[model samples]
Target: MNLQSILSQHIIKAVSESYAATLENIEFQATRKDFEGDITVVVFSMLRTVKGNPVQIGETIGEYLVANVAEVSKYNVVKGFLNLVLSDAYYLDFFTSIQNFNSYGKVPATTEAIMVEYASPNTNKPLHLGHVRNVLLGYSVAEILKAAGKKVYKTQIINDRGIHICKSMLAWKRYGNEETPQTSGLKGDKLVGNYYVKFDKEYKKEINTLVENGFTEKDAKAKAPILLEAQKMLQKWEAGDPDVVALWKKMNGWVYEGFDATYENIGVDFDKNYYESDTYLLGKDFIQSGLEKGVFEKDADGSVWCDLTDEGLDRKIVLRSDGTAVYMTQDIGTAIQRVKDFPDINGMIYTVGNEQDYHFKVLFLILKKLGFSWAENLYHLSYGMVDLPSGKMKSREGTVVDADDLISDMAATAKEISEELGKIDDFSAEEKTQLYKTIGLGALKYYILKVDPKKRILFNPEESVDFQGNTGPFIQYTYARIQSILRKAASASGYTESVEIRNLTLEPKEKELLKILQQFPDVIQLAAGNYSPALVANYTYDLVKEFNSFYQNVPIFGAENPAEISFRISLCDAVGSVINTAFSLLGIQVPDKM
Candidate 1:
């Protein structure tokens, strides 16, 4: 058991023996910074059961703990808080017992399985800054879940079929003379995205011309010839027109290649990919069943709707009057298909933007109403949009910051700052390039993951890559520093394994570092439970801060004794291992030589 569990058991015994009163539970908090204690027990909570002055009660518990608990070296009663200082031997014993620091806080895989769907990008455009956040959040959460012992399958649904796609195809056909990714030297997605913008521009011009001719703006927008043609293209594609299908497949192939390069650049991958084209028709049969069972109602227009009004949500359409499936139907079908694909997956996490928060709520409720036991385990990892300092992005106007561009800019920024620092003089050109990529992507991932997923971020590349404060480069530099120390220690003593630390009084700084290191496993579990990488990110920052304080205040290689030096070096090794493990969970890489 951990320190807290041991202390709680002893505290319960102390309270029972001292006051002859049984306690049901104990409340604890981190010791205040000004207080000389490792953990604080709240004495005021006992007042609800055993009536007495709070101070007297606190003193009684503190005295009882010091007398009864072996780890409790001393205690002080500060008001109703009983601050208990743990013995240095306790921390030293805990540190010495840890044999493998590399895999220290990770858990073995459990039977329970979860599917995390992220980076569900549309095939029409290259990934943008918004997708950057989604992929990073989703990937990190999946890693965190794995660390917490769940069998996780990473996947995404490719949004390959829709009217938006038809717009791009039509734009390409009307404007281009058989241009392709190879001939244009543009990524398939970017080329298609350019056409999408072109279609919007032309469609708007048509709308304006019709309005000038006395047509209502709404009617003009709907009646625009380009819009009508795009709709017809969609219909033809749906009807399996061979030529239309061929064009759709060709364009989607290019987009998929573009998306693959982007995902690879960002260091995120998936175990499976679902296509909208295949899944869109999946829920029609389910909708019929829901209608027959009165779980859904058919409107007068012969459209199918799920009446969620009793559940406090508005009615959601499942199928159009023309018998075409809606997005909702497609999603329901996708969920069922996934369960069929992975029978062991008991839960799913949809890592999407917060705008579809209600959509997920209704989806989950409908699944539960459909009598799926796993629906209760479904979660929507809703997150806010990422805004640059410039402002919001509009995808259609080509104003969104492309994911590929942002990643490239981050590397360039890292290269500039690292070159200015002049810290890698011994590195070759290729090594330098690799290190720059590591630092750049690490900064990007860390900066985004460090924030709570629900909060919008105003990302600044310069700030994230800085080597000071709560940034990725700062933590990475510290890890490099520890590696340097280890290399020296190995050269000096010819020993790299952990040494047994016995009968030595650890310095305050050493004990503090060990205390923080011990909390890593708990932090991972907490992060996984909340599906928040921010918790893991911030915890790592705190650990780094603690290690820095220890490094500055204590001596390792220059220590007077061999045992002390070995113990300190071991501590440094442990810290570096943790830094690497934590960064891995965030999908960030750490460099050995910085």
Candidate 2:
């Protein structure tokens, strides 16, 4: 029932009646700024059905539309484009029709459900800048899907059991004099992460000592006492040694608490969590079944493989010769287990780095070959790495930008910028602190999300907190401005309700704002289909820019006509509501005052 659909129906009728030709569809685009029209129809596309010059065909259709459609007040044809000028009544009716702009664009949840996996981090180190991008992208996509009427479940798979985890446990037990997170006054993950780094340092020392005694570099590394002990610890843990298992549970418990704090700080949560210890061996049964069904092949060494050469991928190992499951095996089992847990989910999206693109491709192909219907709906939201202005991060060396530290730094940066701007001079201490966090986090989320997921990001904290240009603070400031206008309007009389306006003229800026506002629902649908938060982020920036232009050029309070002032106030309110809702989809908060 939108304008495009209405025009398309009428244009089809016009083509059949005038040219005696059947037009299957109509192509529409935004009217060029130079042209005085609301929407344009490409007559060039219609030439296949209507035999005539493009301009002539456009004119014929324009005439038919102006004559038949009430909304089409006037029209002009330039080259092959039929630009239709809609009546002011149409835009007015649109503005009046939306009762609540806050929830205006969101659709009610549908029966279709999807599981989005993100922030699946290893237990060895604290989450860093890369994980920040993953969580933000995943969280935003989930929100966008929900807005598009899909039931969504957010989840993560913790890498809790591995040789890397053993390294940390070995280091902590050997180096520390009974130090704990409580005693050390450090986060549990950071404490464990320190031991992980310590292990590497000690292991290198042992390797050097062995090399000095005439051993080869490779042999020295392989024979390092620290590494050998760590490997032995892994074997013991696998054998369910009581002592090692208890230590793992205790350390991992502390690490989980630390992880919960970080996740809370970053404003993301998982509906369900899958642990590697629990799911690592789950795919062995599936591998045996697959071998029996000819979906997989068993090598002479007793290893299981999935031959994907015909599908343009090499053979992938499902189980080792020792009958132990590989990472791929665990992932397959985890995916299947998710479906069993959430029966309504027909699809899943894995938000992982682009480095694992091939892995996901192989995983999806194998699942499809195994005859799982839902496997066809699987998607890999592969994103590029997030680098800092300094350089890339290495987790083992402990040089990665910690998520907690980055968040704190963002807030600190916001404070510096806000103090310099002196905008929140009247804010109380608590209010100022809260505002700083909002602006800082908003800036961080927006700067990263504004770019396409496939592109690498060189994040700059100071740059993101800027109050001008296409930054989060800039948009937040505009939203706050609209709120100020609304407050002023509320204090004045006769602007309480936005009633229908009759016998009134519309401003060009007002019409432009209406046009953009009308595209919100469609934009949400587009963003949802593409699984891209960049679309939603950029759309919000465009809306904010348009609103700012309208604010400067149009008179909201000083207008002579009461109806005009009321309508303008209503327009401002609608824009603010949308800004709030759009920011919500990006997991960014817009302040009422900044």
Candidate 3:
């Protein structure tokens, strides 16, 4: 079922005897180009201080494979690379295997439970483009891991408490006297975001008046009553001040309402969510536990700190002198809580930004030092920032793109393009709506996941990703086309023609597409193995590209032999299934027509 395992078995059979009966992990990797064949088995790692050259070693392996491996019909030895040519029968079996199982493309199930925390945003503002990147990457990674058979629990800890949130609330109280989202015709989060921006303007003006009398920025910030009141507001809400709690709930609900639409549009959701307001006290208890075990020490200022100086890290304050929990403290407690809640969990993956790489390193290490063995499985799935083509987006300057607005604009643009390209001419209402949604989301997800996660992407709105070529909609459309061909073939065959692919004519197009399909399971495994959904992104694009090439060159069901017609039709169906499965992983859907 796992393609890589089977291929490695074939490779080991070919090369193990030459390695003196001691070789393991034959290391057969998929090739990028078709000329090199599907799977290339490397022989260098097996040879150490060898008397024979790598070229000679490769030569022996290739010959052995061609002679001994029945599935490998041909072989080439090129610079320590053994490129294998799989027999048509192998592809025939693979096509039949996948086609027989309607759920063959579904992610296999596993007993290992995982908690993936991502999209941890404050309730003060509308979601931004950066959040989009985080959400999609998180969603895709969850989908990939699930595909590899993991019981995944998606979660997020909302930064719903603190001065940042109060800034928005304060501005609303001062300037928005009884105005609501319904009255203003603005989204709840965007309406709240307007006040967040307003707060910065007022804060800057008030701070300037203070600085004119020689007050430093820090002193001016301290002197600001609004800042003090915001902190008081947090305390009041915590101590069961009904009025303060009511206001907090009202504002936070507005943000959540807007966020739900964004999450639905992007196709990302969580299994559970934690609020900072609810879990802050839990952090203090964990700090006390750490102190009791000598994992932390109270400073002269009465602040609890974790001494990480030996690790070239700063001594981090887990709790302030006033006994309030810091961000790191809350994370520690939440980690403990989740593991306790789901003791059978195999791992916890925090899909966070690379800026917090050091933070996660310390957190994981501290958890281990505190005697949590499962800390070893806790991973930080960090990704680079998504900056604009001009530079990074600045929120205080009000240049940040709103997530809802951006998607709406993209969908509108997509609809316009659809009309221009005549793709919308023959569609019913539902069909047109589906096409629009598919194109919109496909473009967005593909653009975000196309690059490697660690590399920051420079996104330019003007030079946006195209739907006509090398884009998600291109793949989506191609998939629809494949389905169309299959439908036509099925009707012509009277829906009962099942052909034996054992003698499928090995045309160049058919062979290439077959090989690509055979590698889908490995693509899923590798994507899940490296915790990178970009692998699936790349694989899906490559598969679509191969399918297009095959379509342009090979005419299916036009051949003389019924065997050839049925074989080609089934293979096409297999290709469509692969594309559908792949699209689902990236949270993109295939439109039946486009």
Candidate 4:
């Protein structure tokens, strides 16, 4: 057991024996820097059970702990805080107990499983900055859940149908003189995206012409030839017209190839993919069953609605009067389908933006009302929009920061900064290129993930690549430094192997490092419970900062004895291992050399 649990048990015993009162729990916090203790217990919280002045109670508890607990070497009372100084032997034992730091904090997989849905992008345009955030958050959360001992499946639902898709198909067929991604030297999604922009431009021109001929603005828009053709194309596609269906499959095929490239570039993948064309009509049967069960009502026009007024939400449409299923209907069916597909999964997390918060709230509520056992475990991982320092993005106008371009730009930025620093002067050309990509991607992922999901991000690429102060490069650099130290220690005579340090004296910096290291497993558990990668990101930054302080103030190879050198090197190795594991959880890579 950890020190906190051990201390809590003993402190509760002390409070009961001394004050003749039953204490239910113990409250503990990190010892203050000004104070000389390893951990601090808040005596103020114990007053409810132990009737005495806070300071007096703290002294009585401290006296009992020092006399009884072997770990508690000494103690001091500051106001109402009981600060316990643990023996050096306790920390030494902790260091020796860890068999392997590389897999140190992760728990073995449990029977429970979870499904995380992210990057459910539409087929109309290439993924942009907003999708980047969604993909990173979802991927990291899945990895964190796995580390926390849950079986996790990463998935996405591709929005591959509807008029938005037809717009691109119509534009590409009408405007291009038989241009293809191969012929045009453009990514398939970008090629399709270009046509999508073209359709909007042509549709606007038609609307303007009709308006000039004395038609109202609304009527002109409704009567635009390009939009009308696109709508007709959608109808034809829905009717399973051979020509239109073939065209959709061909165009959608191109876009899929483009999307795969981007997903690979960003280092994220889905275990399963659900297509709108396949799942869109799935909930129609469910709607009929719901109506028969009184879970839904039929309107005068024969439309189906779920009355949620009692639940503080307005009536939601499930099926149209014409028996056409709505997005809500499709979503309900898709959620149920996922459970059927993964029988062991007890929960799911949707990683969509905050704009759809209300939609998910209604979806989850309806599921619960339908009596699904897993509905209570559903969560909406709602996150704010990611804005660039310049401004917001609009996809139709083709002004959004393309994911492919942004990734390339990040690498370019890393190269520029690295050339200025001249740190990789000795690296070969191929080595330098790979290192640049690692550092660049690491900077991008860390900057976005280090913030709370609920908060909006104003991303700055140049700022993220900085090599100092809470940035990815700074932490990566520290990790690389530790690796270099390990290499040096391995080559030095008499310091190549582990040393038994049962009787070694502990330095202040070494104890501080140990204290921070001890919190890793607990931090992983906390991050998993909260569905927050920000917790893990910030914890890693704290660990890196403490390690840097230790590295500067304490000498490893120059220590007075080989045993001290061996111990310090071992600590360096542990810190490096953690940095790697932590970065991996965030979908970031650490470099052995920067």
Candidate 2 lDDT tens digits, 165-251: 999999989888878999999899989889889999999999999999999999999999889999999999999999999999988
Q: Can you tell me which runs of candidate 2 are displaced by over 4 Å? A: 460-465
Model 3 per-residue lDDT tens digits across residues 1-594: 465676666556655566554456667677547455767877677675334677777777778767766777787777777777777788777766664434554566868888888779989998888999888888888888888889999898898987788788888888998678789887888888899899889888888888898999999988876667767876776688898777778988988998898898877889999888777667678788899998899999999999989888888888999887787888888889988878888679998889999999999978887888788898898999988877888887887877877787778778888888895687887777667877888898898887788888888888766777778888988888988887697568433455566776588778788777767777888988888878888888888898898888877767667787777777777778888888888888887677
TM-score (C-alpha) between model 1 and the true structure: 0.97
Output the worst ten-in-a-row residue range by lDDT, candidate 2: 459-468
> TM-score for each prediction?
0.97, 0.97, 0.92, 0.98
**Model 3 regions lying over 4 Å from their true place:** 1-65, 76-84, 99-102, 105-107
Question: How far is 448's C-alpha from truth in model 4 (Å)?
Answer: 0.4
When sorted by TM-score, best at the front, the candidate numbers are 4, 1, 2, 3
Q: Which residue pairs of candidate 2 clash?
A: none
Q: Give the Cα RMSD of candidate 1.
A: 1.5
Report lDDT per candidate: 0.89, 0.90, 0.80, 0.91
Please give the lDDT score for candidate 1: 0.89
Cα lDDT tens digits, model 4, 373-422, are: 99999999999998767778789876688899888888888899899989
Candidate topping lDDT: 4
